[model samples]
Target: MQKEGQKSSKYDFEFKGGKNNSYVFETNYDITYEVKFKPSSYLFDERYQFSSQVFEMVIAVTESKNLDDKIPPDGLIMFTIAEIVTDFFKNRERIIVYICDTADARHLARARKFGLWFEKFKTTQFMKVDASITDEMGVIYMNALILHRENPYFVEIIDAFRKVTGGYSEDK
Candidate 1:
């Protein structure tokens, strides 16, 4: 975690696609990505009464290729994202989750599921339901940042897990 008025955390990482080189590119065999927590809004009152902080969590799948051209399973994707969020935030509060995949656009259903799941998370955590849309990609592009709950800014990224899979999967 960062200080009350500290800047966002910039993180870069890489990992193997999956077993049997499934998620690797046809040529390359690894996935390069970045998860950045950019602070947007700080709650406070007169006298600089800083209470909680809001961050725009940005995740980028910089390099990912599949031998069979198959995107990773939703479960895997959710698990990966959940872990990333949990590890990054580590008990922080007043956070907003944002993820957009306009590059390889999937379906709104995916985003809706993530949103609903986050909504459920709000029941227990400080997350916001209005955030966490899984409809579009690159919503949190390198330059695509926004104030949580502001117009044109309504989404959240997960950084904690009450259970495996973040309790988002209905199959469980």
Candidate 2:
């Protein structure tokens, strides 16, 4: 929307490769993600109450038209998402990642696997995140991953997810 080189002070990140940048959204089908979260966990039970501050980011993988072709054999998207998570941890940012991608089912499954990989990281304070994967439409799915500094119980939820998914538990 900002037309490549134009920078908006209102946004948190500027596109590195202009409009052609893989992260910039072209069609609604492109790789897009939204994050909504709150600073406090007291309203965990009341979902409708804590839906105030939401942050969104787009991650459109380039060089490929279909989902399977876009994902590298070495799992580059997972690695990049991991880096983003680490940056949030270092900055002490509490957020929920809503990944919406028009990729294949395998890619969405991979995202879930990658979310489980977050269990290996432990910050100074008890940090936990429960990543949920759900269907949005055909070839499109949403992964809602929540990170909290105060709740260590998130680790258990992630572990349970990993076990349920059965992909990340293969000892990679």
Candidate 3:
């Protein structure tokens, strides 16, 4: 946000926490993939589909400091991303819960019942959701998965922050 007297500066690259986009997923042997919000937004901000409110997280890792080779190549982006995300959530008690995945039949089946899933993780906290939508060409390339809160604790944090600071990242 621009300050009372300061002007807004342009950013070099735009981030992807925006609204209304489609994606897919695909797999073969001992599968796993991530529904990275590329900056994971508040999971249900879109799922519940409220027009006025876009409760988002600062999911962008492409901050200048992140330009280092820490970004692993494509396909392996998950391991690096998961590490960062896990560590990030650790710092803020505000982020109450997170769900990750490992694709398998039993977990997939459970996801149909529970809503999210992580194969490496025991079926304790997360409910697995299978996102293998194959089309005529082959396996599904884009899967639009939603990571929502069965509990709204994260939302409470967002609301509280808004109440206190009104979305400005820092004081001028």
lDDT over C-alpha atoms for residue 161 of model 2: 36
User: Which of the two, 1 or 3, has more lDDT?
Assistant: 1
Better of 1 and 3 by TM-score: 1
lDDT (0 to 1) per candidate: 0.37, 0.40, 0.30
TM-scores, all models, native as reference: 0.41, 0.39, 0.26
Q: Find the candidate with the highest TM-score and give its number.
A: 1
lDDT of predicted model 1: 0.37
Report the Cα lDDT for residue 2, model 1: 23
Q: Residue 135 in model 1: shift from native, Å?
A: 16
Candidate 2 residues lying further than 4 Å off, grouped into runs, are: 1-52, 56-58, 64-70, 75-77, 89-93, 100-103, 122-142, 150-172
Per residue, candidate 3 scores C-alpha lDDT tens digits across 6-110 of 332311121222342111222211122223333334433443433123222222232233234343333333333344333333323323222223333343433
Per-candidate RMSD, Å: 14.2, 10.2, 16.6
lDDT of 2 at 105: 47
lDDT of 2 by residue, 129-155 (tens): 333434454444445444455534444
Cand. 2 Cα-lDDT: 0.40
Off by over 4 Å in 1: 1-29, 42-52, 66-70, 97-110, 116-123, 131-172
Worst 10 residues of 2 by lDDT: 20-29
| Residue-pair clashes, model 2 | 0
Per lDDT, what order, best first? 2, 1, 3
